[model samples]
Target: MAERRHTDIAVIGAGPAGMAAALTLSEAGLRPVVFDMNATPGGQIYRQLAAPQVDATLMGQEYIAGRSLVDAFVTADIDYRPLSRVWWLDRDGEGYVLGVLQQGHSQQWHADRLILASGAMERGWPFPGWQLPGVMYAGAAQILLKQAALLPSAAPILAGSGPLLYLLAWQYLQAGRPPALVLDMAPASRYRTLMRHPVRAWHGRSYLLKGMRLIADLRRAGVAIRQGVSGLRASGSDALERIHYRHAGTWRSLPGTLLLTHFGVVPEPQLMRSLQLRQHWQHEQQCFVPDRDATLSAGTNLWIAGDGGGIGGARNAEREGHLAGFAAIASLGRQPTKRRSATTRRLLAARRRDLAARPLLDALFRVPEGWLAEQPPETLVCRCEAVTRGELDEAIAQGGSGPNQLKAFTRCGMGPCQGRQCGESVTRLLASRTRRSPDDIGYYHIRPPVHSITLGELAADDFDNTNN
Candidate 1:
């Protein structure tokens, strides 16, 4: 049998939510084990300092906040395991059986309760020549900037939708090399649609102000900020050289070494889904959300927090984490003080209100129609499988009604990444072609070993089916 460890609470993901939950749980007299795939505590939002001896400024305030939380956790009797990727989780009686791969070895951790705060990923929309070299996701560009302090290119074109585009553009301008051009997909009229909700409008004022500042900076920097880029293509034999875009009903091509595109973010629920946690199709958010109660509990002992629940940004994620921590404490038969319960209730209410804006935002900025229309036959849809959009279309046309059939035929979702990138897109395309809702089509079925593992690692593990 594999060696086993136990803890009062197990928090997966060392991002803001997981770190916050661990700190709070420790304060409440519980020893928590926190696992993260990265080498440090900060999640993607607050990525860890690149090197151990690197100065803290390299990571910025996001990571600094996580570091402070980690410091507090250290004093609270929490066991922090970095660079540990959890691949499999099974419910063991009242707790969970967590399979983690660390240092080329397999291990297990049993916990009285498990909190998932895995966070979100940048949603990718397929476009013409998007697979070309130097064409990267906007979030990837931000990661390069945040972790390496390196600009993607000397003259990059920023194109796509969502708040991250402006934020990244502002960062580039602050770094002295503003992007060559800014092509926004969301028309100005979208804001008028978003204005229907006064609360959302109020909550979004800061973003509007930031966008104004970014526009002003771009103007001063002599960078062109165009309203729309309907199409994006990179034409070059070897490296990226020129970008073709459709702006204001006119097609224009510009010379650029790199192109960064984003269509906002989507909940990363692969781990959660693999655990068989009930998920609801969030039509408003255009993503799948884990089914959770008011207290952030997904079921009996499984809890979730942050953008993994939905895309409400960092502040809302922190509030949800605090609620999950209190709830986990309560689940352990500990009675929280009246004051603490009251505070948690208030914060939960605030989070609910904040998330209410997601519907309008999702509807307004939903992936543009015909976004994938120009996808060439050879354009790779599933990077892991190297399956193209045309291949998927042909598979479906040949009576591949669901993801399973499509996978069997084209191997679209059968790769190392295991459909994280292409599953949703395939589901959407399949549903559209068959005249069915995405929910009816359902998400791809997940099996054991959600993440890829080496053969040696699997062979070494003692599979005790009786224990499970």
Candidate 2:
């Protein structure tokens, strides 16, 4: 039989938001259980290094700040279960039933409240040969460098929009191997264009400073930094050998062993979607965000924080998480101290101001038009089912092949990756061919056992395992 556990609150994900929420809840006299897929509590923003003795030197001061927050949570005496993947969430009476797989065993937990802080995922823009062996998301390369101190390759091309591309490029240069080129999709002039909103520009000063630092370093290193590269493609048969792009009314090809591309970040809402929560289009960020109240409560005893709500980065995520914790405690008929409430209100206001600038930033750094169209017909669209663009197009032409029907017909979304890499592309293609809105196309049907589990594990279950 699967083991059963109970807690006052169950926090999904161990990133900054989850850790902050768990710590606040624990301090308020509630025992919260924190579940993380990784073996550590830092999440992606505070990703720890493989070597135990390497202090904050490798990750820089900003990342070390995140480490300090993790340390505080560690001292708060909360139940943290690392390496636990939560695949299902069901309404149980007035609370929630969380289905988790830990160390190859299935388990369940009942919590009076649940906080989702699953964080964000890198948004990808498809192009010719994007599925090449050495072509990867910029965030993926950063993970490798953070956890293993390994660069993507000696001569890599960083191409994309947003601040992360420059940050990763700087990291690669600092690690003794400067990237071959920095092909920025969003031109530098866009920043000046956004300056029309003084409040927004002022709020984003820190990000601007970081970008300036990267540009200065690139100039000093004599690394080529192109500000307007579009129509990117990778070339070579087995592995990535070269990257081609167009810039400033000219086509340029750079020889490199690896290509790192990123458009921006999107909320990692797989668990939230699994729960059938209402989601709405966030036009500012070009992504879907869970419908929630000002206090960050999704509904009932369920709360969502951090990038799972929307991409607000670390500072905004922490503020939102603390508010969710206080709101959860207040729901139990316990009012926090007046001073604490006032402080939280102030922080929340600042977060609002910061998040208000997201629309301008998103507009300046949005994904290019016709990005997915750049893909060849043979390019792999669905990595899970090995479905090519040709296959998806054919399925759409057959009629009645919406995103869900296409999944049923081709098993396009029925993979371990859970459609993270291909869902957006598939939805766009379906909408274009069906002449329907992307929202009308809808998402795939998600069921229990969201991730693959061993057949023996499923057979050993004793309780009723039904999908909602």
RMSD per candidate (Å) reads 3.7, 3.6
C-alpha lDDT of all candidate models, in order = 0.77, 0.79
Clash pairs (backbone) in predicted model 1: none
Query: Residue by residue across 402-434, what tens digits does model 1's lDDT show?
Result: 988889999888988788888788877876788
Superposed Cα deviation of residue 212, candidate 2 (Å):
1.9
Worst 10-residue lDDT window for candidate 1 reads 51-60
TM-score list, all predictions:
0.91, 0.92
- lDDT tens digits by residue: candidate 2, 300-352: 99899999998888877887778888888888889779876897889888987
Shift of residue 45 alpha carbon in model 2, Å: 0.5
Candidate 2 yields a Cα-based lDDT of 0.79
